[model samples]
Every structure is written in structure tokens, then in C-alpha cells.
Target chain A: MTLILTALAATVTIVFRFAKQKTAEKLRLGLLALMYSGAALMWTVDGFAAMFAGEPFVELQNPSVVADDAFLGICVLFLGAAIWAVGLIFKKATKKAV
Target chain B: MACFVVPAAEAVVVAIVKKRADKAAKLQAEALACGGANAQTNTEQKARTKTHSGEKISISKKLGWLNAMLWGGTALLFLEHVWHGEVVFWPPFLTAAANPADTAAMLYEIATSGVAMAVLVTLVWAGMAIAADNISWVKAALCKQKEGANQ
Candidate 1:
């Protein structure tokens, strides 16, 4: 499920943030963690709802759906990284202007 | 289905809060500056000014970080829902709006999932603020910025 991957990404980001506080903070690692965690939280709700409805939380039998979710997980990861990068550039530009 | 709406709504509230916080920070800075004007020695005045303005980041700026997180994540989730056909460009916006039964389910999802996500995001932001407040590097950055300002 996308939730699984995004949650993993969030954990890794948080770990790396602690591992290198100075560089990681400059990269806005917390923002990336927030982004992944939001998606993970939503997907977690979806997972629970699915289980309550007598449906599997993840359709392992359906390779296509699994693949789709994996792709989406990667996309979300890249998108979050992109947003953080842009924010960094913008902050730098503003500091220069100031 | 409509889960993204909760965080999206929260983002609007956060933006407004950020605005007010910015104003408050500015006013506080001004008051500090005025108060420091009466300091006895030049060095004392400089120290007072540095300490006042040397905060690593303004409260409003930290709020802006939270806003960015909420808005960015919500926007992406909205697009994902749209891609899955859960959301639409129509009047009610959610595809579940067409059916009474499905609409109730959607409302349940919003109440549970949406509220949870929003709360979790806020909690994470609070944790981030607390962590940054304690981190030595963050303080060093604040001092460096103050040095730059003084120069």
C-alpha cells in the first residue's frame, strides 16, 4: 500500500534529519517528513476503513494495483522533495534580496 | 473521499493565523527596539537589540512552515483523490455526493480520517518547533543571522 511506503519514507527522513541536523535542516527535512506523514495518516485511515468493511487493507493478489500504489508512493516522495527544494531556493533568494 | 478538505480548511485558518502572528511579531520587535533605545551604554544597547531580534525564526515564520506542510500535502492528496475519481469538478465536488448511502460513508471518512490527519500534522509541527527550540545548531544559526544583521 502507498501508506506503507510513505510511512517508511517519513521515518527515514526523520532519521536522516537527526543524523545531520545542520544540512538536513537547511534542506527543510521536517517539511518532507510532514508531507509524507500526512499521506501516511490518510492512507492509514483508508486501510482501517477497508478492514472494517471486510476488505483487505492491501490487495496483494492484485499486482496491478500494488504497482500503481508503489508508483504513486514514489511520486509523492519526489513531489515532497521538490517542494522542499523550491522552498530552500526561495528562502535563499529572499535572504539575498534582504 | 473528502478527507483532504479538513486539512485544506485548516490551511486557510493557519494562513490567517500566520498573518496575525506576523503583525504581532513586528509590533513586538518595534516595542523592543523602542525600549532598547534607553539603554545606558552603546554595547548594552547592541546586546539588547541582538537578544531581542536574534530569535532563530519568528513565530509567524514557523506558522508559515506548518501552513506550507498542510497546503502542500493537502494539494497533493486532492490530486490523488481526483485521479482516483473520488473527487470531481461538479457542484458537490465529491463523486459520493450523487448517492445518499455513499455520501454518508464519505462523511464518516471525513470525520475520522480527515480529522485525524489534521491533528497529526499539527502535533508533528509542535514537535518540530520544540525540537528546533532546543537544538544547538538552530541557536548558532540565530546568532549568525544576528551577526549578519549587525554587520
Candidate 2:
């Protein structure tokens, strides 16, 4: 599920944020952590809401459905990375302009 | 439901604030330029403001970090909802709006899950901004200790 993927990404980013000093800060690892963790939080809330609505929080689905969910999750992951990349590019461009 | 809208809305507000801050910065820079230059003092002030990383970022820049997080998260969640057919390109947009019962449920989701996401992201960003600003202090202390050791 998307939740699990984002949560894992958040965990890894947070660890990198704290463990590495120079490279992590240069890469803005904290922003990446924020993106992933925010998605994970949103998904967590969605899961709880679904459960309250009498739906399974997460369930095994048809293979196609599962595949679609997996694909969507990957896309979400890439989207977050893309946003971070754009931010970095913007920052670099602004620095150059200055 | 349309849970992503909450953060998207917040992003809009933050964007306006950033714009105002940027305009103010620009005007201040212009004023500094117009005034007769105190080159030596200006250099001294710049040096005093410099962080270990070389520049002390402004409040606006800190807001930028939060804006990016909110916008990025909102986009991702919106995409996921669209993938599941909860959102559509048609009028009303939300699939849940077709039925009254579903509409109520969607509203509930927005009230709880949507608001929670916005609040949580903002809280995290607050913590991040505090840490980012304090990093200068921490690094400066360490540098001083290193200089002491050298002496």
C-alpha cells in the first residue's frame, strides 16, 4: 500500500537526516522526510476513517487491484522526489541569480 | 473525499505570505542600495549575520520549506485519490458528491483526516524550522570549541 511505502521512505529519510551531517543537509533530507511523513500521516488518517466506515483498513484484493495500488504508490513516491528535485533546482537557480 | 484540499488551501495562504515577505525584502534591499554605502560596516554586518554554512536564511526562506512540504503532500494525496476514482474531472469533481450519504461521509473525512494532515504537517515544519535556525548556533559553538582547542 501507499501508506507502507511512504512510511518506509519517511523512516529512511529521517535516519539519513540525523545520521549524516554534511551530505544530508546539502541534499535537504529534512524536506524529503517532511514530504514522506506528511503523506504517511494523511494515509494513516484515511485508514482509520475507512475502518470507522466499516471497511478494512487494508485487505488483500484482486491481483489487478493490488497491482494498481502498488503502481500508484510508486508514483506517489516518485512525485515526492520530483517535488524535492524541483525545489533544489529552484534554490540553485536563485543562488545563481543572486 | 477531498482531503487534499485542506493542505492545498493552506499552501495558498502560505504562498501569499511568502510573496509579501519577498516584496518586503526587495524593497528593503532597494532602500539599502539607495542609501550612501557604509562599505566597511556593511561588510561587518554581513560577517556577523553569516552562519557556519555561510548565510543566515530569512524567515521567508523558512516558510518556503513549509510551503514545499504542504504542496508536495497535497499533490501526492490528490493523485492517490484520483487513482482510486474518488476524484474526477467532471463537475462537482468528487465522486462522493453523487449521493447525500456519501457526501456526508466525505465531509466527515475532510473534517477529521484532512484537518489532521494539515495540522501534522504544519507541526513537523515548525519543528524543522526551529532546528534549522538553531543549527547555526550549534555549529558556531562547535567552531568556537575547535578554535579553543587549536589555541
Candidate 3:
């Protein structure tokens, strides 16, 4: 479900980026697409692994998978935020040039 | 140390950005002073009578707002997972629920997050409008100043 949501987010941002004229906005949108798409891909691989291995997909009882996924999602979110901050700098640059 | 180092780096970047912004604004004002801005320039007040109509919001602003909504929705979903005291990192989705009660809970969560995403998108759109308006106001002010000095 999280993966689906992340993928949806990626789609929305990428689609909207098409309409934007400014580079700064595009950069932020591109970063968002990268983050969400990456998270979604990670989850999809986890699902495939579970299917191949004949395991209950979620295995809520297993702290291992849950912990790992949560950690990864958090890391992705943080990384996205970091890139967004960098984009802010570029945004200022773009604004000045315009 | 990561926290300190990160902010310091960000601050330096921000300083550079601010300096550039001011310089750029001055340059644009100078350009407008040279007659880059004219009567035909888009404006909402004259839009009804004008052939091209008033200025439309830029794609960049729209995309920026959408990007914000995407992040907002993701954050809400993360919070929903944390609230359950367990992560649903893996998903058979409803099938993973062992009982009817668990299934109901899972469905409820999905519904809630779906609503949250919608709400976030709406809020972002409103914010974008306000920001766009502010930008226009600033531009109008700049145009007025340029015209005044010329007259």
C-alpha cells in the first residue's frame, strides 16, 4: 500500500512537471519523482522476494521486514528533503536571473 | 555533528542565493526601466478587454504545489503506519489481515489516507494561488515604480 501511494505520488509530480516553465520547479519535481519512484521500486522488489520465497507478504509478526522497510522509507524521505533544500538554493538563483 | 554540518552548509548556500536574488531583482528593474515592460504586458485588471487576457499562473508554480502535495500525502501515510505501532512494510493488503476485524482496520486506514491525499492536494492548490497573487503584486509594484520614474 505504501508502495502504491509512493508510486502515485511520483506519477502526480512528474505529470505536473511537464506544465512548468521554470527550472527550479522542475528540479524539485524531478527530485520528488526520483524519491517516490525509488521507494516504490524498493517495495516492489520486497514483494517479489516474498513471493519467490513463499512467505506471507507482510508478515506483520516479523519485526525484521517491517523495521527494514520503515527505516528505508524514512531514509528516502530524509534524502528527498535534503535535495529539496538544495533546490531552494537554485530557486533563488533562478529568481535572480529572471 | 551531521545536524550542525548540514545547516551550516545550507546557510552558506542560502546566503549565496539571497545575494543573487537581490542582484537579479535590481537587474530586472533596470531592464523594465529601459521599456521591457509595456502597456501590452498581461494584467488581470485589463484582461477582460485584452486579446490575450490576463496572466495565467505559470506551470512551475503549479508543479511546485503538486510536489508539495505529494510530500504531504507521503508524510500522512507514514504517520498512519507509525500510529498502528507496527509497519505494514509488506502487503498482501487486505489478504494479510487474519480476521474480519483486522481487514476492516486495514480498509479504514486506506480510506483515511486516500482522503488525506485529496485534502492535501486541495490545500496546495489554494496556497499556490496565494503565492502567485503575491508575485503578481510585486511585479505590478515594480512596473508602477518604473513608469513613475519615466514620467
Candidate 4:
């Protein structure tokens, strides 16, 4: 799950750099990437430490919690990315018309 | 985090505007130069003129405020953390340990990370402002080159 989130975040970050409209798309995608990667890194490191040390991870007992957190994180990331992408496309179209 | 984003965006916007203003200033200078104005005299006069003019006033003034706010807010947040200790909603598990040495390490890490992020964000903002200020010259040079080609 951590790896998934990290990958998603990194993907979004890369996409952000290439989508050059210099609009909100950049911010939305960049922030989404940062948030997802940050959360993923935080959770993955913590989760791994707990698993390796034979200790109970904070959200380990709640299988739903892990899924829920990851879901929410991904949702935010994707939503932000989509919004940014749409905005960029719209901006480009407008610029072309002008 | 949101606080940081606002300032960063503001910085970027300021930078863009500054670049535009710089381009305008440079074009004006080039136009003057093409008309046989003295290089040094025109530059000094342009500088004096800009100091009095309001062309780039918006960017400079807005960015100045943003810079102050970002740095000030970051400092206040850091001081708040120092006074109250780690104030994050979810303290990391390692930091939750009761051992004094472990706790100290965690606190140090948190403090260092916070400071580093704040500094990094502030620097980004500063760089944006500087870029905004200089971008005008870049744009002016490009425009002038284009114009020369047309001629």
C-alpha cells in the first residue's frame, strides 16, 4: 500500500512537470503528488517498522483502516490531479483560440 | 502546509509579473538605445524613472508582503513548536517512545524537518520573486530580437 501510494505520488509529480500551461493544474498536481508521497512514505515506513519489530502497528488491527486511509489518500491525489489536468486542457484550448 | 502553498503561489505570480515588467523596462531601454540614447545614461535614467514609476509596483509590493508573511508565519510556527513541543496531530510512533534519548532524537528530527521545510519553501518564494524581477529583461531581450528580425 505504501509503495502504491508512493508510486502514485511520483507519477502525479512527473505528470505535473510535463503539463506546462503554468496554471492551477501545476499546483493541484504538484500538491497532490506531495501529499500522497508524503503520506505514503510516512505510513509505509511506520508500517514496515511495526511489522519487522513484531509490534502492533497503530492501524494494524483495523484492516478497514488501512484500506480507508489509502483510499482517501488516493482519492485526494486523483481528484486533485484530474482537476489540474482539466484546467490545463481548458487553458490551452483558450490560449489557442486567442 | 496550506500556508506554505499560498505564499509559494503568490511568489510565482509575483515572479511572472516581475518578468513582464522587466521585459517592458528592457524594451523601453532598447527602443531608447535604438534611438541613439546613451547606454549608461539611459540605464541610469530608466532606473530612476522606474523608481518613480508604478509599472512593477504591484509585484514588488505584493511579493514583499508575501515574503514577510511567509517568513513570519514559519518563524511563529517554529517558536510555537519550541514553546509547546511537537504539535502535530499524529505524532510518529518512534516519537511516542518514553525513553528520554529516543524522545529527544524524535523531537530533534521533527524540529529539523520543520525548519528545513520552512527554509526551503521560503527560499523557493524568494527565488520566484527574483525570477519575476529578472524575467522582464529576458522577455525584453527576446522581443527585441524578434523585432530586429522583422526589421
**Candidates 3 and 4: which is better by lDDT?**
3
Interface RMSD, per-candidate values to 1 decimal: 3.2, 3.6, 12.0, 10.6
Point to the candidate with the largest lDDT. Answer: 2
CA lDDT, candidate 1, residue B19 = 91
Q: lDDT for model 4, on a 0 to 1 scale?
A: 0.46
RMSD vs true structure, all candidates: 4.3, 5.6, 16.2, 12.3
DockQ score of the complex predicted as candidate 1: 0.35
Q: Which ranges in model 2 have alpha carbons more than 4 Å from their true place? A: A14-31, A51-68, A85-98, B53-57, B135-151
**Cα miss at B112, model 2 (Å)?**
1.8
Q: Which regions of candidate 3 fall more than 4 Å away from where they truly are?
A: A1-77, A82-98, B1-54, B59-61, B75-96, B134-151
Best-to-worst TM-score order: 1, 2, 4, 3
lDDT of 4 by residue, B4-106 (tens): 2333344466567657776776787678677754776877676555543323433444444344434333333332233233434454423234467766766
lDDT string for model 1 (A3-98, tens) is 788889889986876676666656767677767776676677677778888999876778999998788777777777777788789988998999
Number of colliding residue pairs in each model: 0, 0, 2, 4
List, residue by residue over B1-151, the lDDT tens digit for candidate 3: 0011222233345446556666775676566557545633533235333212224543443444444444433443344444444444456332327577776755554454343334434454566456544566533432333333334
| Span of 10 residues, lowest total lDDT, candidate 2 chain B | B141-150
Shift of residue A10 alpha carbon in model 1, Å: 1.7
Q: What are the DockQ scores of the candidates, in order?
A: 0.35, 0.45, 0.04, 0.09
What is the DockQ score of candidate 3, to 2 decimals?
0.04
TM-score of each: 0.76, 0.75, 0.33, 0.33
lDDT, candidate 2, A1-98, per-residue tens = 77888889989987876666456666777678878887887787778877887987864566776677778889999989998898888978997999
